[model samples]
Target: MNIRKTLATLGISALVGLSAAQAVAAGTIKIGSFLAVTGPAAFLGDPELKTLQMYIDEINTKGGVNGMQLELVHYDTGGKAKEAVGFAKRLIKKDRVDVIVGGSTSGSTLAVIPLVEKDRIPFISLAGSVKIIDPVKKWVFKVPHTDRMAAAKIFEDMKKRGIKRIALISGSGGFGKSGRSQVLALAPEQGIEVVSDESYGAKDTDMTAQLTKIRNTDAQAILCFGFGTGPAIVTKNVRQLGIELPLYQSHGVASKKFIELAGAAAEGVRLPASALLVADKLPASDPQKGLLLAYKQRFESKYGPVSTFGGHAYDGLMITVRAIERAGGTDKAKVRDEIEKTRGFIGTGGIFNMSPTDHLGLDLSAFKMLEIKHGDWTIVE
Candidate 1:
């Protein structure tokens, strides 16, 4: 009887040891991302995903954060807010992620914020919306500046160029409406006049009617706003209508794909964007030079080239990983606390200063004016 008891006790001990080993093996930190990889906003999400992958790969190579491998599991939201909410629930409940990243558009990010707050997981949004960080939930953070800041920059530049009368064209989408509202609200304050205001839906391929109306007006410039393929259509229709005035666009259309989509019309178009997008024009003395170069080289080595969307993703992931490392564990609450204290951490975007009051960590100073010249972006004075 004693011998039989001893054998059973030994077996139980061995089973416990095996279970502990399995737990340790499965302790890898999982990060979640929701993007519109297969929808109208794929141009934005695809590069953002690629950049997240590149940063994850690099972090792992240098001994991952707190000795735990960072695993990013992403869902395709297809540019729908409902899809984004569903995906957020899955990431929080099923995947049990330590953190979440990657929201391609403002509407999708806004939809997922509540879930992130409820689950007490830190979310670093890649989308640019002042509202995303404004009412500032403790768990929600953003790496991109708000659309309001970009709109201000556009108007400031217009004022400098002596452009008083402008034509405003925006798609009837979340980003478009937000940008149009901000511009209209701030134009009078900045002494700029909107001679014509036009709107179009995202699916509309032809904008000649809107462009023609603006062309007939005494507007000295055209301000285009949209994230999807609408900007390209507007650019094409403007050229087709022989409207040769200066063209200014929101940073939402700041990507190499925009140039490809707009073709010749893309040339000489100005927009406000994070300095990382125009790295080539920055001198070596610039603070962001080293970081941007490293990111560019690593990204190009992994994925063909870099884009502004990719830079935002890289900044978001890096900030999240840094906070995780500082926390020394994957505890959600601890990570959230550390993220809120992140100050003066230089990123490709700019210095991040995530406080309890402000989660965006960036302001208008984080952006620089850029103009497309000869199929490439150059910093504008």
Candidate 2:
């Protein structure tokens, strides 16, 4: 599948005037977004844009919340933090959007944090990083699982398989660096030992040197941390080197595109992923199964396949609407408080329980230990 062609196009209707605080004058409840729809992380941000647009169109058709039309003003950040910060300022200072849902990458999200906090605009980041919500910025929240959560889930599964010594090969990007820090920091606490640690840049096309160094170690399994094409390159390199060690990847690669990029080499790869990957395989009694299947069916009907990245956008948008309704108006402070009070909300990623101190709000049960089998996700038995 040519995912580039399948991705959603950027949608921006009109630019807001210089007055940033006037949502009413903007003519609707504006939702501003900054995503990486055309960059290296387009695999993630493109689908996210589609999901948000789909939901907004449906919501508007259904009379919208409190008899108000929701307008989306989004820009493509192209995986650049500085660009995202500029977009955040534009959304708040110029567009007069009531809420901002974006910052597709970990680095981009962090770069926009101070801007959002200073402006007092409610920010719901689509990026994956514990740093986004750890100390809890008053106006910031997230819908995806963090790098710390992914690391803990992988280590838990590794221990179950009697794997103790492991090797790490992570991209030098923000996502990889945060994941690497978590894995190394939690290894000793999880009863796992790191035998090797290697790094590669995001633009690096070959990881043969890193794989060779990792293979030389007495590592029982290898964990690769990266997003988009970088990890796929590592997978291909590991296979070409004829390495027998079990290869595991980060949730950043939770899409069919990764399997296609890695081809036959993707088989048997494991990762800690959101339940959306194997939603149909989940027990009917599970709370998130129905929600997951609904999203999958709707998304596949239009886009041909499903991805967790889009699911993150779906959850964030839905959550934003809910907060708007509970707040009873488009007031940014009221919406932020209502969002923080969100509890028992079922999202595509997991059950959300937002508090002032914890914003991401998902537990270990959110991720499943999944393996690639016959080019699809299957629960590792």
Candidate 3:
């Protein structure tokens, strides 16, 4: 044990320790997102992806989350459930993401929840599905209001407005079916009778027949539900048939593209949406005003104008980041536990409260009733 040899070994050990510490400090946190970037639901997924990119860019520019750069790895599910499941597995097993976000629809979100839960990763679903958070799953959370909540709001509004009869049309998909069932189930309680109920396939190009039947009924309004191109078809056909009754829709049609696709037909359409979309018209001192403006300016600077879908993504990702910050690390389990304890989180959407029994983080109060006027969404009292 010569003195020179002892000193050399001690220096080598110290260098190795410093290298390990640096590696840990410089580690990157990977977030995975699956969306229908190229399929029928591209209208929703494209803006959501853009929002995720904008948020990550801004976070990185501000030194990132906890001094670690955030990396978002996205996959295009093409509106297919099987592809979503496969991508989720790849994100977990290969990319090794710290969390998952930005699923565009209920089907895609629900398909990936099991994979996330199996891998014990935190997943914040941007999709609006009550089932995504129902039963209080530990690894899953959602940003948008559930179809049941939207249905209740729509029906309650109709009842208040003295609409006694309604015709329902929804696509034969998970999102559509869920919304339709919720509306139908809640109509009786709201004292509004569903005069006629009809459904069409997701790929249907025209719903003339269904709209005609509803038009012949004594319904005062048409309640439509679907994602992708189905909603557009419903709106177009309803207009082409010259049905003058009011059209109420699910929040899935909150995107600007929905109005573009439906053109003039969407003028009087009504739906429930997060307050962020109509924030410009809200009072300046509103609680969500600051956050919404900040998010809007950052998003527009990074990637053009922001859409409602983008707003949802921004809210979801920010909440996820806040949970990680509170946890002090990227440990998935710890973050999930903290997320369930989220309270009074004043995000771009609204205040949220996530509990062990409530994973959506939002309630009926989170949504504001809105109507499309002159191709723009206007808040309704």
Candidate 4:
């Protein structure tokens, strides 16, 4: 998608500014965002922006929240940490946004942690990293499942299949680095041995060298830790090298785009992901099934296929809006407190039960073991 051109056209009416009616409305609640709209991580950030703009317009049509119209002022960070930090500062100081919701990657999210903490703005990150909330930054919260949770989920499945030794091929990006670290730290606890570990740069197109090295190891299975197009390349590389070992990927690639990118090579690939991808297949009684279907239908009808990254944006926006309603207004402190008190919130990601200590508010149950079969996501029982 031409996100740059789309954003340029949207800037006049939707995303970066308010409409004439909104400007003269009873009041306005400013929501600031910074995302990787045009970069290596555009696949993640593009859907997120589409979801936000679509839903925010929907919400505004419903008379906004607490009688005040919502204003979205966002910037494109291009997946850069330094750029994210600068935009975050501008969102807080210059735009004076009530809440900030963006940060499409762990590195970008982490870069602005100190700024959000010091500024005391209610910030909800779409990134997936345990470090974002491990120490419990008062103002920061996240929507996506943490990388640590993804690691534990994958290892749990590996143990179930009795796979003991595994090789790791990971990208050198933020998600890959954090996921690799988590896997290394948790492997021993799960009784799984890391036989060999290989790394690749973000821009690397070929991973045959890494897969060849991993093939020589005594590892029984391979776990790829990376996101974007990197892991997909690894998947294809593994198949090209005739590596018959079972392949596992991190949740960073839990979207249909990965399967499309990897093509037939994605067959038999497994990863941990939210139930959103297989919403139609989920049990009728599942709490998140209905919400997931609704989100998927809405997004697909307006834009294209739904993605897990977009679901993160959906949950983040809804949670923030719900908090605003509960607070009875847009009081930043009150909204943040309400957000912390969020209980039994059925989002596309999972049921969130936020508390003082836990900002992410999700357990391992949020992730489902999904395998690609015939170019589709099939739940692994």
Candidate 5:
């Protein structure tokens, strides 16, 4: 009896070891990300990473997909493109993540694209630059409304207001450069003239010099295309230089932080933003109202308040999750195909309509014209 028991114990131990080996071979479905979690772009990446982690935990709580737990590995790129490229390679080659959702800034997204394309991995970027999807790389996709779309929306709004001459002041960042290009290229088609196009460094504390140049132009309206604190500086500079042209910012500064940064100077400033900014104000008839409200509540409940940048990350992660569910497995090719076939999916950014040719999947309608009133965001009726 003792000999028989000893043999059974050995057999059980060997079976357990083999099971462990098999588990290691199969591996969990890896979801990797790299964002500008620290540094100048922290405002964008902090909320994004938080929202992604929160939703991921929620998914795990409900039980992960296909009876396997999801594994998330993240790195901070400090809003630097070079840093982003290194991490992208590590996530794919070393960590072997099934899907990647990141590149918080446009520069970082553009930086990581070559590696993602070469590896043929499905990369859903949170970056806002239209250049991220313009060439239409098959393996790459994005969540934010393109800068081109935002520019078109702004120009259309300007035309409706009977404004003709506009000045463009952009930052040297990829996002600002992309916005400037689009606005310039589309202005003639839209029957508006760009009287002045000025640029400033991302870290420039003041833009009085650029505003001085813009003041000399016949611009009836001024478009300041930048993110983070650059736009705030423009607002202050515009007010200080006594330039009375209506100031319109890009959607990059569609957060309360901008108002706080610019203080009273941000008053009456106009910009384009997603419905998520004024979700509570949206009527019940609006298609995006429910989804926007739910997301806002969920995010703000845990992480203070929601930023439009955070919505970009939320869109990327949800789209990735939907693609995984639709594909029914961790097959990279199948998931990529599923993501490409996505359509009519209403997200925080817009109603996504992905295809072989259009990876960003947003339109001009995604933008809601907004104004800053008394340090608060109000939808321009």
Candidate 6:
């Protein structure tokens, strides 16, 4: 077998005969994944899968982690929770992946939580939802800043501007719904009132009606909490209706694709995001600057522009690998314990300090408030 070729390219033929223990004995570590690689949420999962493959390939090239070659067994969930459940089961039962790093959406991640916890396997989710780790499931950890964190960051920014009585337009999907709930739950404390609240279906073509409704309200600003193209459409609709009330978006649309999709309408739009989007603009003193720049260069060179979603995958995979290294092997229990013990681990998102009660290992500081300026990302102070 050519060691240079990524195990992801080896297909099932290579993973067939190795039992979980046998695979470890044969100097291989399996990392199973189930992502929405091809679906409405493709924007989130496509780059995620690519980032995983790229890093795994690079890691294997420089002598595998702890002298063991890494193998990936991934499945496409098409952004569906039911499909995610089936694929996750396959990964746990058949592929026997020592650790799982997947779930492009909150729905998918939440669906597979029971399975991972019951099976006693370590799972690092890439999706952004507080519920994924809020209750603190033993076997589950996550990379992206939670939706609740995003909400808090946005609310803090709004408070800074002395903005009150805001409108909320959200998507009905998992991330959007969760983010909306958090925003509502946290707004009262910030002295922000929900002047108008509306939601659009995940596949909704037009949000002009929602924008019109929000415009009629006595709202000071509008916050759109949604993922994929839905928020982009909302951005366009807000512009189309001439409703320029200082729009804010959730971290869901932190990718350059949102700017491209929403065109000039995206300009002046503010959102919470990772430093990955503005790597070059980050000050040299920032701890994540060097790592973010390196990851940006590598990913953009191989793929196109890097997205925060991909960065989430980068953190998840590296965190898992580091946990395995700390555990000295892929013993499930030990790895899980090490993952929970991760502290001061700098990643593309932020410095992680996980604990028994906090599996996500990130605070509001993990998100940098950003705005779209001149068709590019600009840091918002």
Q: How does model 6 fare in lDDT?
A: 0.91
| Most accurate candidate by lDDT | 4
Residues 1-381 of candidate 6: C-alpha lDDT, one tens digit per residue: 576565655655566654655746568899999999998889889999999999999999999889999998999999999999999999999888899999998889999999999999999999888889988889999998888888899999999999988999999977788888999999998889999989999899999988888889999999999888899999999999988699999888887779989999999999999888888999889999999999999998989888888988999999999999999999999999999999999999999999998898888888899999999999998
For every model in order, what is the number of clashing pairs? Answer: 0, 0, 0, 0, 0, 0
Show where candidate 4 strays beyond 4 Å.
1-26
lDDT measured at residue 47 in model 3 versus the true structure, 0 to 100: 80
Model 2 lDDT per residue over 80-123, tens place = 98999899999999978999988788889999999889989999
Over 4 Å off, model 2: 1-27
Local error of candidate 2 at residue 211 (angstroms): 2.7
Q: What would the TM-scores of all predictions be?
A: 0.88, 0.89, 0.86, 0.90, 0.91, 0.90
**lDDT rank order:** 4, 6, 2, 5, 1, 3
Alpha-carbon local distance difference test for all models = 0.87, 0.91, 0.85, 0.92, 0.89, 0.91
Query: Which residue pairs collide in model 5, if any?
Result: none
RMSD of each: 4.6, 8.3, 6.0, 7.0, 4.5, 5.8
Clashing pairs in 2: none
- List where candidate 6 sits over 4 angstroms from the true fold: 1-25
- Please state the error at residue 336 of candidate 5 in Å: 0.6
Q: Which has the higher TM-score value, candidate number 3 or candidate number 4?
A: 4
Tens digits of per-residue lDDT for model 5 on 95-194?
8999999999889989888899999899999988778888999899999888888889898889888999999999998778888899999899999999
Candidate number that wins on TM-score, 2 or 6? 6
lDDT of 3 by residue, 111-200 (tens): 888778878999998887788888778888988778888898888778778999999999898889998888888888888899999999
| lDDT score, candidate 1, position 292 | 88
Q: Write the per-residue lDDT of candidate 4 for residues 199-301, one digit (tens) a residue.
A: 9999999999888888888999999999888999999999999899999998889877799899999999999999999999998999898899999999999
Model 5 Cα shift for residue 283 (angstroms):
1.0
| Model 1 collision count | 0
- Mind sharing the TM-score for model 1? 0.88
Better of 2 and 6 by lDDT: 6
